[model samples]
Target: MYDINTKRLIKTFTDMAKISSPSWGENAMRGYIVNAVKKLGVTARQFRSGESYNLLLTVRGDTKRKPVLFSAHMDTVTPCDNVKPVVSQTKITSDGTTILGSDDKAAIAMFLEGLRYNKEIRMPHGPIEILISCAEEVGLRGIKEFDTSVLKARHAFVFDSDGPVGKIVLQAPYHSTMSIAVTGRAAHAGMEPEKGINAINVLSEIITLLPASRIDHETTVNVGTISGGRATNIVAEKAVCVLEARSIDYRKLRKQEVLIRSIAKETSARFKARCAISRTLEYSGFTIHPDAVISQIAATAMARIGIRHQFEVSGGGSDTNILNAAGISAVNLSAGMQRVHTTKEYVMIRDLIKGTKLVLSIIDIMR
Candidate 1:
């Protein structure tokens, strides 16, 4: 077992998890982190975006080596207000009404513990920057809108993936979000239903043609939300659907995107209605070799801590995508969080402590 202060990490996690820090409303959580850093005798700065604030803590004077950034988001999903963290002997969870907030808070706690340990040990290390961001759970808006120009870290480690302790995210996929609108002429359903075209039917045909589940090994499509038809007695005038497709291979992604666009236009023309389709490149995908600097650093850290180092692909998106897009080589590491974004969310205390030890080990290695 790795040497780490389990009590301190869990206490700090409990304190933060109990706070109400949903998506864009992270005022309380931000204050807690800022104050906690100050109490630890470290100064932190804030970067503002809309109603949320991102906290940045720098440790430069201690080490004269290259810089590395450790990032974790402070926000959680909905039903997180008034969280009650239940700490069992082996696990930590919520009271079943709200999320336990371990998705990112586990990272926050582990980072804090590692910082505290480093301070106590006075270990010689490289420049380290701690980034506690906001509004990540919603759509990765915090890191997306962030100004990385102020950061000098060449490598970043994101503590936001959900898995066991020793897993490293080797690659993430590129995502294309599509918003489509299907329009059809509206007429009274009882009187002239035959004269009107149904927008819902047009959209349904397009969806069938488009990929929904697993398209390939590295690609997947999902229809998150759709709305159409105001009343049963009337033909639908307009319908809208929000869908997204992600793929590790750019060629495959483009092909599927083209197919989706084709489906939209063809179905719209067949129904004699207008089809409006727009796609946004949400974030670029990245594939990091295991021998890369960041990956090597983490693998060495894991080996030093006597943990198995396994690199895997991530289907979900995180702040790692934003950092990589900003030209910083990075990988998302698991924080030992399980069943995130639900009332059933829980994390093993053993895994949490192991995760903390892993961060501490990475920091120690740079020293």
Candidate 2:
């Protein structure tokens, strides 16, 4: 076991949080990490990207075993810029005016702290790689664009989950983003209301027919955003809704999609409104077998670090979905991020220390 520098970890976190990095605005964070790692005698390479960049750092460990990749997203959700991270007695948080940037910053600090501790203590381990991805908050964009074909690691751990430090998310639901467009005739609301088919009315019918909330324990639907209506005096000519559905079961997920499409077609026919529906598979769901080596390794590591091993299934998808799709087995590890993507986001100093220890334990588990 190695001791993590509590002060150094906090400094890295507050420094990175103050960078004000959003999805596309990750260059500053990347540059900071590159320089920070270089100062630790570790070389990092940044890949060229359009708005965001991906960084990779490789360090040869004591053995010839396969490398284990540790991943953390560089970007936080909106309202991240101008973040004022405040370190208190037990945790670090924001001033409530902006997000704390702890969604992944906590994990970023843990990764760096783990590296420094491992190097100082001369921990016996295999090769190690750290992947700092950008634009993950937007839609896992960085990992999507990253060339996984160039990666040599066979196993990966994504430290971006919420909850305690030992939570291992082995499963997540498949996600589909949908756009519903309705076109109807415009007319005077008071005068020729009968002549116009109100698109808003049609949209309302569609919404009523679809599941507006959780369909089941593992399934859900949400009409996240809606826009329509030109003015209060006239009947709306067009209405649109952006929605998403997710489910862990493939059959249930497909059935939900079919039901939504059927409702759109039926409602459009009944109201004489033109309806256009488009759906994109955002990410496929993944479930790792509990008996797999990765899961066993994480369990052992957590136990070694004196943290309770908790296996969980996330209702939301993550970079682990992309990694599993790309043939790299991975799990999402909780980095003690609480209330992420919100103004209440915060990370505990205790969990940060524990998380860093867990990472080091996982590395030693391999040896």
Candidate 3:
């Protein structure tokens, strides 16, 4: 029997680590969660989308009161297979070659195990919904595919950030991709160099003129990659530059985009070249007021567990961004993970217990 009042943290975490789940390949992991959650006598089911699927488990309570949702992604980044995790002293990490995939799995184990404890003790609380999303590490595709019609929650807690458990991310940047394609005529460098219109040269001018790195207080831009050139002996006929821009403020983002486009236009005019620019929104940003109901609830919950709560802004995007866009007020919660997405990633045992205590504290206070 699973112990609710007792700490089953190690058991849950061990089970989660043994499971293999990478990006689109999460069927096996999703199935495992479904079966594990079913043991709690709660309704747990999977919703299929192409090859991957999302799992939803619901724990009924007295009144709906707009169920509170707990969310975590099921997928991990690549090089996560055959992870040989070891716990030396008080931290857990992998053995050099692969990632431990604790990113969201740790959150998963903590949340589900928390629920099992609450059940065993007959904890009084409102309805709680669990959403284990798939393919979140690659893109927000799994979250994007989720059907809001099936959701009854008005507030969500996305356990996906890396840091202390008491920390909450209420703001994240809007991300966009900007591409510029330059077309020109190719000519032999030694013979007809003067006859060729150099697209690479035009792209260079645009890059130099554009305001990259940091823009003002909240916006940032970077040129991630550049390509398209045949040989050094030839004046390149075509070239392409790919860049990205991010901002917490929509206006600032728009201004940055305009600045980038203006640079491209000016470069084309000065060099007498043809160019095309394109913009695509990777994800929209979200900011919640300090006094927002969800934020207040979480703060109160954390405080009850003796951990000071801090509401802060984040530069990275997560499933919380997508859920917030879907009208579900969601906040990103930190799990005290250090050096994440690296070979040295580790989580302190004390921090893990504190995080679990925070989750349990939230449930106890919810009633």
Candidate 4:
């Protein structure tokens, strides 16, 4: 069993929480992480990706052992400016007005502390790579744009899930995003109401024909945004709706996609309006069985740290999905984050220490 410096871990986490790292604006956070790792005598490479940079740190270890990668995002959701972490004896939270930014920061702090401990004791381990991504909250944009060819590790462990430290995400859904536009003739509402076709009405009818929210235990759909209208006194000539669908099963996801497109086409035609829809596959779904090597390593690491490991399926996507798509087997481990992406987000101090120990344990097992 490895010993974790609890005080140092807490300080590191709180310091990161104070940095404002909203999506596409993670320069400050990246700099801070680079400096922190440098203090441990480890140099990190910053790759320019989109509006931000992706930081990668490689540590040489036993060459005979397989290389392993660890990942976390540097960006946080909105309302993260001027974040003030309220650290108590039990947990760390925000000032009730802004998010605590622990969604992925907790994992970062854990990684840093684990490195410090490993260096101090010169623990036996294999080659380790840490990838800190930017703009992950926006849509996994940073990782999606990242050049995976530079990585030498084929197995990765992502620490970005929200739950206790022992929970392991075994499955994530395939995601597809859609943008639908309805076009119709416009006319004055009072002067020639019958001469116009309201695009808003046609779009509303199409939405009613679609399934939303929870489609089943493994699938979900949500209409996130809608806009279009010139004036209240005029019939709307154009309207647009943006939404997404996700499912663990690819066939089910395609079925939902086809159904949505068909309904939008049929409904718009019935209203004599033109419907244009664009759909993009954001990321493919992934599943890692319990018997897989990556899963076994995670399980063994948790067992070594006395953490009761549990398998879970997430409705959301993370860097893990993208890594798996790149042919690198990966699993997302819970970072003890609670109520993430909100002002109520918090993480337990105990879980933070446990998470750090888990990281160290995995590295030791890789030797």
Best by lDDT: 4
Alpha-carbon error at 283 in model 4, in Å?
A: 1.7
lDDT values, one for every candidate: 0.88, 0.88, 0.83, 0.94
lDDT of 1 by residue, 1-367 (tens): 3456779889999999999998889999999888877756576998996678888988764446677889999999979988999999999999999989999899999988887877777766777898888899878888787899999888999998897888999799999999989999999999999999999999998888887789999999898999999999889999999999999988888998898889899989999989999999988999999889899999898898788988999987889988998899999998999999889999899888888888777766764
Model 1 vs. true fold: TM: 0.95
Per-residue error for 239 in candidate 2, Å, reads 1.6
At residue 56, give the lDDT of candidate 3. 87
Q: TM-scores of the models, in the given order? A: 0.95, 0.94, 0.95, 0.96
What is candidate 3's lDDT per residue for 275-360, written digit by digit as tens?
99999998999999999998988898887667888898998889998899889999999876767887677666666777777677
Show the lowest summed lDDT stretch of 10 residues, model 3.
1-10
CA RMSD (A), model 3:
2.1
lDDT, model 3: 0.83
Q: In candidate 1, which residue pairs get closer than 3 Å at backbone N, Cα or C atoms, i.e. clash?
A: none
Model 4 Cα lDDT, one tens digit per residue, 65-176: 9998999999999799999999998999999999999989999999999999999999988899999999999889999999999999998999999988999999999999
- On TM-score, the candidate that comes out on top is 4
